[model samples]
Target: MTTHQLTEAQKKQWEEDGYLVIPSFFDKQETKEMLDEAKRLCDEFDVDGHPMTTFKTAADGEHVGDEYFLESGDKIRYFLEPTSLSPATPDTPSRLLVPPSQSINKIGHALAILNPVFRKHTLESDKIRSVAKSLGAQESPRVLQSMIICKQPRIGGVVPCHNDSTFLYTDPPSAIGAWVALEECTPENGCLSFLPGSHKLSRTATRFVRAPGGGTTFIDVPGVEPNEEKWDDMDGWREAPCSPGTLVLIHGSVMHRSPPNPSDKTRIIYTFHMIEGGKGVKYDEKNWLQPTEAMPFPVLF
Candidate 1:
């Protein structure tokens, strides 16, 4: 699980850009094994919404907006859209969701991922934490939210742009989200597009709701411009593209969204969020349909 320790230069880049791409962050063998396990899960699970194999061609022969046509998937089943049973709600207090793969091998791939490398990549890494401290973070962060996104091809829908801070009711108003790319990502393949420094802007949207047609949309934070160019110019506003072994570390305030997987291949990615440990922030678990703990698992520090 060893990796090239974060460098001073990379740390500086993260502080300035708001995000950094760490290449080859996972050991090749480990990555391969994880991918193998994901494939196995796809086979065993009763995938419902759209099979990860359909694609819609564009008039220009480009794969741009095709992702908006595919359906979203629940690891337990596929979803044509967000349902009452789904926890993808914005008003919800605690939104963390874990994958079903955790029980596969007992000490299987899931545990390996939760092991040192992945956790340390964002939590304990001195370089990353140093950058965080410079940006005002105190203490190591907790892996408060985690989930696996199994993006099947043509399984498209728009997860509109919004700040994660809006959903997390906390003071000092901050958190960190890391999205790991499990497959090669491209715009046509439904890769994520961010509004650059949109995270620094004041809350443009206060509530989250689904668009009439089907896609999800958020109410904009007052005072922010709907202008596109402003966000497009942010230092870290770049569209991140990665191979199977890269990770995207993002601040909680950052505004981001991704469309459906339009390509025939599946774009599987895992996402995790962490808050400064001992922050005293509590999650209202009473609303949960299932008996979920405030902090479901121990922070892997």
Candidate 2:
């Protein structure tokens, strides 16, 4: 079912909790294909440190060759604001084939569900219809393709707490992100955490910075401290750890992120976005690059 067909109870839960985990969003076959496709793309895609231009470094004493030693906090900020930094440099490979915006295409039937299931049958799907109705944009459920987030064990990355909207650049603020876990995601494996009611915060608070490996971070504006006390008091502000095929829907403005995956296995997950297209929205060419243009994939409803 599409998000549009969500019941009142489901919608209420999302509105109150900022996110809801819908168990069994994908079957075993679909899950396997999605993981396989993501791995295939990731193999072709290279991962490098963020470039030096996007942010300023702190006065840390450690030095590694010509690179500056950035503090833990600065590293978070630096990667988040990669307006200038890049994954590759002059000494690296030449003639970059991947887009700076790391949207990759389907290698197999992996992402076929996103295009056909969500787009072609969106009007007929209950879930999509319910979500579209809630957003007050029933005619346009701007559901983007599903993306795979793979983090290797021990070397799993740290994604500091941030929002999802900053990267979309959507005005009037009505985008939603639905993440489906392909593997068991525990706190040890860097499960996502969210600040309850954080979505109620102004859209202005969400900031975008270029992230490592050519991704982007949707962070809170600098110097604006989050309500730690409120988060502590609210039961809703919690960690969401799920087994494979679990789906969690989150508002785009919610403050959220995943910590490092300290586990021994790789963590894989699929993330998709829904945009409401009534409020005079314009695409941000720099960020919205999809993989279909560079690579083609099959679509299956």
Give one digit per residue, the lDDT tens place, for model 2 in 1-301.
Answer: 3343566787777777677777776567656765665565555544355333222111221112112212221111111122212366679732323243232211111232433432333223455355446544224545553445655565455666556666555555556777778888899988988886777763544434444444444455455554444333455557888888677888877877777666777677766666665447644443322334433222111
Residue 179 lDDT in model 2?
78
What are the lDDT figures for the candidates, one per model? 0.48, 0.52
Give the TM-score of each candidate: 0.60, 0.60
- Candidate 2: global Cα-lDDT? 0.52
* lDDT score of residue 97 within candidate 1: 30
Off by over 4 Å in 1: 1-4, 47-138, 204-237, 280-297
Instruction: Give the per-residue lDDT digits (tens) of candidate 1, residues 1-301.
Output: 2224566787666665556777666556656755665566545643234322222222222221122221211012222222112343567532213232221111111221243444444455554454445444436555544445665555444455555555433344556766777788778777777665455553433433334454333454454455443443355545677888777777666766676655777677666665555656543322111112432423434
Question: Could you tell me the lDDT of residue 222 within candidate 1?
Answer: 53
In candidate 2 the C-alpha lDDT for residue 171 amounts to 55
